[model samples]
Target: MPNAVEPPSASPTRLEEAYALLADASGAPWRPLAGGTDLMVQMTGGIGEPPERVLDIWAVNELRGIGVDADAIVIGALTTYTELRRSPVVAEFVPALVEAAATIGAAQIQNRGTLGGNVVNASPAGDTLPVLLALGAEMVLGSAHGERTVHADDFWPSYRTTARRDDELLVRVRIPLALGRQVRFRKIGTRRAQAISKVVMAIAWHSSADDGPWADVRLALGSVAATTVRARTTEAAIEGKRPTRQTADAAVEALTAELEPIDDVRSTADYRRLVAGRVLHRLIRDEGGW
Candidate 1:
């Protein structure tokens, strides 16, 4: 009898070759690794496991960098939380981006965990997501054939997953250059920094064209529904109308209806609903929605 060929072994060399082979062999599934923050935790705790080899792509330099273009800021997939948190551009131009980055676990987690990994992890509590949603960001996906640009709005087709194909890689995130948009980001956590948000909100909008009303509002929320959502009804209620207490109250009502909070260890569904709306109200009122 002919000798049976041995399956791929779980070695570093095998891990390195998996990507090269899978780039052509689409039939096999390959688990890509980086800091392995979430993956390692899941694997160690038996959250899940795979029979195939893992591709350690952390060393790929192409996936790491931060730069700004004429129309947008580009963040490479491998850019870590620490890099983003400490970036001056993040603080000056996208303060919400910095706020969100600062809240992703502790320093160690920030150093290793990457933005791409966070997006791929697909958690409702992912800190950067609400801001990205509000920013109208684009997700750039790549495969052997070429690259495809997907709006962040369209990328999350469902919970804990994105529109990334079986054979594609999430390469980078592109954020549109926003001007004079009074942005505000807030998170309610167990303590303060380095904690998962029970409630999080990011609002990007200008005060008004001529002190008339809220203009170009994009209010995104997290841990509210199945995925982070822009509060359209609330936005419509205030758009083109002078920012006032009455409008704020109406916006809160709209927000309450927009989100369908669920019960979880973090908080009660009812509490999440009330707080989510309140966060919107506060952000608009104090954080410059007008």
Candidate 2:
């Protein structure tokens, strides 16, 4: 007779109960499940073994809302892309995030995919990642021990990995308000819609004057590196320089030198590098009215 398969164990818990479960160190690890957008796909596709214990946090209401404080906009981890796209707070402050959220999958995927899941998944092609990097977002992680915050720049250290500990949950994200900054987001993919990104870029900057040096420039890109990376070299090339054809050229040069994309099924390294430079040039030229 064939050995009977043990069914997976799942526990639905509230926010406090979830924390308690995570705090207990002796038991088998419980995999946290929110929207399960990516996890379900992976599980059904046989990409990995199913978790023996699943911690269902969908009912953890404490992790589901958008609010604003004096210095930053707070977005709960479980907030869905649909909610992000429709959020008036997001629209007014970080419109690039709204644009990114709209590009995720279809409406159904957007409705079910949570922001925390996207960040935790740490996919280099994730749409919102570049935007978060450009905006200098901070993640609030919570566990039974306590809550601590980490900058988005320090969150993802490698491809498909994040700094989140096994015992902690990403509770919320805080985006510092940039009231007068110019922001832009662009995503290039194999198809016009509902496709994974080939190259994605987001940039934020404050102009010193109407047509002069740019300051506080934050340029970030995805699908061109192991992790979504801040294009610091490219940003340095543009910094304190007026938006011009020459500046754009220098930026392209620096960007080309900095990126080390891989030849993957979605795109080739050469093509991704070329597109990233082209996008940077266009962004600089558009901002300069050239």
Best by TM-score: 2
Cα lDDT tens digits, model 1, 1-290, are 22233224322333224335447564456666767888767655556544254556787778888999898889998899999988887677787888788888889999999999988777787778888988888999877667899997887778777888766777799988867676678888898756778888887777645345768888888887777777788778877766667777988888888778889988988998898877767765664344
What does the lDDT come to for candidate 1?
Answer: 0.77
lDDT (C-alpha, whole model) for all candidates = 0.77, 0.89
Worst 10 residues of 2 by lDDT: 1-10
Q: Once superposed on the true structure, which residue ranges of model 1 sit more than 4 Å away at CA?
A: 1-19, 49-51, 208-212, 288-290
Q: TM-score for each prediction?
A: 0.88, 0.95
Q: In order, what is each prediction's RMSD in angstroms?
A: 5.0, 2.5
Tens digits of per-residue lDDT, candidate 2, 147-240, equal: 9999999999987889999888999999998667878999999776689999999998987576788888899999999999999999999988
